[model samples]
Each structure stands twice: as C-alpha cells, then as structure tokens.
Target: MGLFALLNRLFHHGPAWLTFLVMGLAAAGLALCSFNLLFLFQANYHLLFTYGAMAAFDGGLLQFIELTAWGYLAIACYVVAEGCLEGLLTRIRRAQL
Candidate 1:
C-alpha cells in the first residue's frame, strides 16, 4: 500500500511538473517574440522618421512581413501551452473518476 501510494504520487506530480515546464517555455517564447516585434516596429519607425517615408517603406516592408510570421509562431506556442494544460486537466479528471 505504501509503495503504491508513493508511485501514484510520483506519477501524478511528474506530469504536473512537465506541464508547468512546457507552459513556462511557451511563455518565454511568447515574451521574446513580443519583445522582438516591438523592437522591430520601433526601429522601423525611427528609420521612417529619420529617412523619408519611401525609403523606410522599401526596407520596412520585409520586416513587417517577418514580424507577422513571428506573431503567428507566438500564437502557435500559446495554443500549444494551453492544449498541454487542458490535456493534463483531462487526465487528472479521468483519474479521479
């Protein structure tokens, strides 16, 4: 009985820890992406202010597109993190049953 209880606790906590780790990583990724996106926009805006609109637009267009892709990637990471939590919750609920 003691051994089974110990094993059960280990198994239960292991997945919880794993879920937290994954969520933390995903949050970090999202923060990095958001910071980069803001930095890029600030730099582009500076360029536009220093240079003319036409010159800035010529170079900044590519940056805008790249940021859009990164934004999507950040969203994907968020979704994955949410899904992981949801899956973990479902498992816990089924175990309780």
Candidate 2:
C-alpha cells in the first residue's frame, strides 16, 4: 500500500493516544509551514516592491530560485500536514459509525 494507506491503517488500529499525537504533530507542522511561507513573503517584500529590478543585481537570480524552492518545500509540508490530519479524521469518523 501507499504511504497514506499505510498510515491510515496504522492509525485505524492504533490507540487513541497515538491518533491524538499524530494530530498534534500535524497541526504543529501546519503552523510551522505557515510561518515559513510568511517569512518567504516578508523576505521578498523588497524584490516585489521593486518591480523585478532587484532580480538584475548580482546573484539575485540564484537567490530568487532558492527562495522559490523553499516556498515549494513549505507548501509541500503544509499539504502533508493536511493530509495526515484528514486521514486521521477519516479514520475517527469511520470508527464512530
């Protein structure tokens, strides 16, 4: 099975504390991702306001690319966190029925 399926199965059969721990970790991940995203935006504020002029400076292209990659990483983290939380919630709902 895929990673999500495996995780779902594990959470489904695991103790209640295990699910809660995973949920808490996921929530913390989401919060950290949000902060990283915000930091990326704030750090690039000058480049944004300059209308791409700052990108003409030395090493600016490399910095921009690095920032883009970091932004993607943060987004991926957010997606993973959301997925984990969703999976846990789905398991909980199914168990309640």
Which has the greatest lDDT?
A: 1
lDDT of 2 by residue, 1-97 (tens): 5976766654566665676676667667656645666666556666655657655365555666776766676666566556556667777798899
Model 1 Cα lDDT, one tens digit per residue, 9-89: 433455677766776788788887777687777786677677776855687667667877888988977875676577577
Please give the lDDT score at residue 41 for candidate 2.
59
Candidate 2: residue 25 lDDT (0-100): 75
Candidate 2 ranges with C-alpha deviation above 4 Å: 1-57
After best superposition, candidate 1 residue 38: deviation in angstroms?
Answer: 5.1
- For model 2 the local lDDT of residue 30 reads 56
- Write down the TM-score of every candidate: 0.60, 0.55
The residue pairs found clashing in candidate 2 are none
Candidate 1 residue spans exceeding 4 A from truth: 1-16, 36-53, 56-58
